[model samples]
Each structure stands twice: as structure tokens, then as C-alpha cells.
Target: MNKPVNRHPFPGTPKRVGRVGAGRGFSAANSNTRISLPGRTLDVSAFAAPASHARPGNLGLNSDRLRAQMIQRLRNQGIQDERVLDAMMAVPRHVFVDEGLASRAYEDAALPIGQGQTISQPWVVARMISAMCENRVPVKVLEVGAGCGYQAAVLAQFVKEVHAVERIRGLYELARGHLRELKLQGRVRLSFGDGMLGLPNTAPFDAIVVAAAGIKIPQALLDQLAVGGRLIAPEGGAAQRLILIERTGPAAWHREELESVRFVPLRAGTQS
Candidate 1:
């Protein structure tokens, strides 16, 4: 859980706004909250303690063993990237979810995180990140539909910087709080804006991962991708498939379809 201190200052205002096809364009509002590290460190002894010492009815709620088991499940499900697995294991999923749902955090299931959005299933997160990093470890990354900030936090483990945008104000705030609690505000920058538009000011990302599914990939996102970079998103309506787009040159791009997925529809504009 130890992270390097960010030497550089946070980036400035979001510059570009992506077009959402028939919908209007929207800008991102960056979170300016100062970084604050927690005074108390998390006690992880429970995770290392032997199972024989476990108390009755204690389902290893805070145990690292649960995370290890989750990682094993991801491997069995076809997640091969060791970096992705380690990153997922490093993050505590329960921290980004609701208290009531904490017990089920490592269950490989998507759980509600308020505002009609759910923290994505663990497998999907690992898959998208694994795909994005397959070619090269991206230095800068953008994440659309950054619900609860879990994916972005996980991305931070593999990427140098992460810029995440969320349209819903409540989820935006919720994500901000969760990231701060995890002391990841430096590595992951959370923004309140339309995710469909993508963060233009920080354009030309080495990799872009969209959490929600759109009927078609947004052009603005495609344009913002750096040359040789890749963008992975879910595309379709009624039924959806994971789409991976690689920017080969200034005017040339390549698209490939992989595994079917279900995600909240990608929307334009911001929610109050």
C-alpha cells in the first residue's frame, strides 16, 4: 500500500470537451481538495494471521486472504496479466463500497455505490486494465465513468497518472472521498463532468478506459488518444461488446471487438 509521493503539482483546468454524438458537449470540473494523509495506518495483521486463529462468525471481512482468493478467481477466469492481478490485490475493494456491502466486496460481483452506478465487477476491471497494459505500461491514462474511483485507484498501480471523470455529482464526491481516504488523491485525479466528453485538457492519454457502454465510441476520445495508445470501452445497446481501439497515426486508427459486457449506458452532460 506504500505509494511514492507525487513530486509534480496537479494539472490545470480541463481543456478539451469531447462530442457525444447527438448529445451536447460538457467540460470537467477538477477537484482542488488538498492532499491529506490519514494519521492512522490500517492494521493488516488480520490478513496475515492463520485461519486457525479466526474467531467464529468472522468471515475474514478485512483479511488479505479474501483478496488473494479473489485474485485466484480472476486467474481462473482468464486474467493473466501479473501486474493487473497485483494491482487488484493491492487495493481493498471494500474501502470503495458501502459499509453494508463490505462483506461482499471481494465476491467478484458488482455492488451499488449510490447514484444508480455500481463499482464494476472485479473481473471487468482487471480485464480492461490488463488489455490496456498488454502493449506497454501507459504513463498517462484517462478513465470515463469513474464510479467510486475503484478502477482509477487500481489503474494507478500500473500507470504513472490517472485522470478520471464522473458525471454524477454525488458519485463524483463519493469517489473523491474514497480516493482521499486511500491516500490516492495524488496518483488519481477525480473530476466532476461528463465522462462521455472525456477530459480534453489532459488529452493525448497513453491509454483510456471507459467504464460505461456507448452505442458507438465517442470521437473526442478517439482523437485524444496518443499515437500508439489504446482505448478500451464497451459499445452497443441492448447487447454490448468490449471494443479496443488503437491510434496508429494522426488520421489512422484500428478497432477490435472482444468479449461481451453489460455496463451503465454512456451518457452526455453532467448530473446535478
Candidate 2:
């Protein structure tokens, strides 16, 4: 496997704040501190979630009704994994997007989330997650390019734990705030680092999902998968196709090509 050119710092250990309640907003207790990465120091306060922004207010849409409608559309599209469907239904998609676009949150379309990234369309998210959960429920999962943390939130509903990494500092902090607002920080660990590296400290994940397209799957990611684990990512440029890789044995892997899809090119290193 090839090594990453640069290594970024991970966030400081999360401290326990007060209990999080529904519709109630809370910030990290250590939000005011600073975390020192290998070559950079970041002000943790920038990642804090304010009470006002924690829970989105009335966005001119009936959240539950719209979510139900979206699930119906998924069913129509052949998303058979009941677990994935249930999870998609449970999470309020609007909260992860800007208020201006909240009305269209339930639509099967990808919306911009700043920083040149989009919260993936509902169908693609459901499809990728369903493919991972087809055979068995993954105990530990890693999500690369966790834009706004929407997919990780949905994955957390059925999986034991989800470790998500984002290379863009803005998106990483955005994801942190959103997950914190949903009170899912405990189940989903958000890391601000290079997604190509694949979180070595928490390696051998049962399943992995990459949100962007790459010329080829990162070798580091392949090595991180445990035996019997599976990874889903988009490969190729311009004409991209979703590929599923299964770690069949210690040194062997099986690859299958699935539906064609489009996504932003996956890049290396983090950006401020």
C-alpha cells in the first residue's frame, strides 16, 4: 500500500457534557480548547454547535410527512433493505442542509453544502448503505468524505459504530455541528483528517463507504478492511461506476461493479 503524503491531526478526546435532549441544543464541553495535530494546531471552538443552530426551526416543510414520502420513493426504487429504509426514515434530512434548501431536502437530488460538496441524493445514499448491509450488519463502519455527516447519521442507526473522516475543515466542522445537534456524536465519531488514509487507529472496519470518486480505490482503505469486510466506492473518471470490494481472505479481495454514478473527484490531504 502507498503512504499518504501528509498526515493531519485528529480531534481531541471528546468530553462528556450534559445529557442531550430532543430539540435541545448542546455544545461540546471542551469546545473552547485547542487541539494540536502533528503539524497544525486548531481552535476547537470553531467546531462548536450553538444552541440556536442545533435544531433547525420550522423550514416550511412537514418533516415527518416528507420523510415518509421520501421512503416511499425509495421503496419504489427497489431499496429492499428494511434496516436501511428504517434508518433513512428516522433521520430528518433537512437538518443537515441549509434552511434555504430545506424544502427540497426530501427530493431525490443532491444539494450543495458549501465547499464544493453536496449532500448526496437520497437514493445514492440509501443504495450504497443497502449494498453494505445486504449480507450482514456491520459492527464498525468507516465513511470517507462525510459531507455534512448525513450518511454517517443514517448508518449509525443500524451499525454498532461509525467513524467518519472529512478532508475539508469546513465540512468536517459542519458535520460535527450537525451530528452534535442530532445527539449522534456518541455513535458517530467525526474526524478532521485525510480520508485517503482511512483512520488507521480504528482499522479493520467491518464495512467502508467512500462518498467521492477516485481513479482507483485507495490501497490504504483496502488494507483497513477486516477479513470478510466489504467496501463500496466509485471508480473511474467522467464515466464512473460504483464498485464493491470484499476482503475475502487475509490477502485476497473480490470486486464487483455495480451501477454507474457521478461524484466529486476524491482528493488527498486536508484543506483549511
Candidate 3:
């Protein structure tokens, strides 16, 4: 396996703030940013727009009712975290998919979002988020494979900031547009870069969630995790299992294997 790419710093003086509660607690920086990272900087401000709460037109199914059913099914499937359930309820999964497939958005299945990528199933997203937050609600989170940005949006509601990276340009732009329309671009920063090379400049993340399955956990991602941070990803092939890795100490981590799962391969580098 190849080494993950090195990440540069956010283009400004980023204060090292610890965990913070939800609500309007996270705010964007307005002043000029300082350039610290080596590669190109992703200007989150470019994707900024006020999120809209307007209801969509009838699309053969009632979104609210379907979303409710999805949440209930998640509950039945053992998703006990109330915050995770609420976030799933709050986000309109249909808005993250193509118009043709919007009707089946809440069917508890993964839908393709072009570029050979698929939005993660609701159950998996909830389970992963719940596990990562099992110890504590993270203040800063990193998401590998931004897909339609649905997971990032869901996570943004629970965490302070979300750094979502996507290796495919098409998927990255698609996610960026969806997130921008949902007005979640503020809290979810989208990047079109390699996923294996976890963003190092934004190191010591409170939580890291990988949407795709890898042969093994990337050491670079583990190195970037804070002491008390948690990282969850689908590991193994042919017989894949969800693995939860918690950074217990500076050089120590505790690993736990959860339920079985099937996910797209986690590829390295960018596809522009």
C-alpha cells in the first residue's frame, strides 16, 4: 500500500478549541486566511449559502412520512442514539440524490450518486455516527468519501465542524452542490482530494468516519486522530466487518469489530 498524501494547514490562524455543544456554536472565519498548507486550499466560503427549509413538491411519496419510517426502522435496527436518530430525521435524504431516484430515497438502501459512488445506507450512517459519538459528541470530525454529502450534513448537525474529503471530482462536485443547496456548506467543508491520505493539517480530529471499505485502517488517519478521538470504517474484503478504532492514548488504540457490511472500495488519489 502507498502512503497517504500529506495535508497542509487551513489558510488561517485556526484556534485549537476543544469540544463544544450543538446549536449556533460553530461560526466561520471572516478575516483573511493565512496560507500554511502546501497544496491548494479549499475555500469553504465559496460554497456558503443560507440553507432553505422550504418543502419540496409532491414526488409520489411524502418525504416527512418516509423519513419518519426510516428513523423508526433505524430504531428497530438498534440505533439507540437519540441525537443520531434526530439528525437522520432532520436531513432530507431525497435532496441528496438525483431527482429520478428521489422517490426511493428513504428505503434504507444506498443509491448511486454518479461517478460509480453510492450514498451510504441510512442504517450504516447512523450506526457509524452513533459509535463514533458513543464516548462523546465530537467537536471536529473528518469524513472520508463525502458521497452526496449526506453523511457530512448529518454529522454537521451533531458536531462543530466536518471536514469531508472525496477523491473523485464528479462525486466531490455533486456533494458540494447538494450540501450548498442544503445550506450545510457552512459546517461541512468539502474537498476534492485523496481519501487514504487523511487531511493531516486538520490533524487530531475528534472523530473520523470512513464511508468506504479498506483492506486495513490507514495508519496516517490513525496518526492524525486525537488521543480521545474515535475512528470507524469498514475493514476486510470478501468478509468485511465494521471496525471501530478509538485513540485511547498518544500511541495506543482500542479496536472493536461490529456488524458485517458491504461498501465500495476506498481508492487513493484524485480523479479529475
Pairs that collide, model 1: 15-201, 16-200, 16-201
Overall lDDT per candidate, in order of appearance: 0.66, 0.69, 0.66
Question: Which tens-of-lDDT digit does each residue in 16-81 have in candidate 3?
Answer: 212221111111111111111234321110011112323345554588899999999987656778
Candidate 2 wrongly placed segments (more than 4 Å): 1-55, 59-61
TM-score of 2: 0.78
Poorest 10 consecutive residues of model 2 by lDDT? 1-10
Alpha-carbon lDDT of model 2:
0.69
Q: Tell me, what's the RMSD of every candidate?
A: 13.1, 15.3, 14.7
TM-score of each: 0.77, 0.78, 0.77
Leading candidate by lDDT: 2
Kindly report which residue stretches of model 1 are placed more than 4 angstroms away from their true locations once superposed.
1-62
The collision pairs in model 3 are 8-37, 9-37, 11-34, 12-34
* Worst-scoring 10-residue span by lDDT in model 1: 42-51
Ranking of all predicted structures according to TM-score, beginning with the best and ending with the worst: 2, 1, 3
Candidate 2, 125-215: lDDT as tens digits? 7777877667687999998877677889999998998998877677777888888888999999888888878888999999998766667
lDDT of 1 at 106: 88
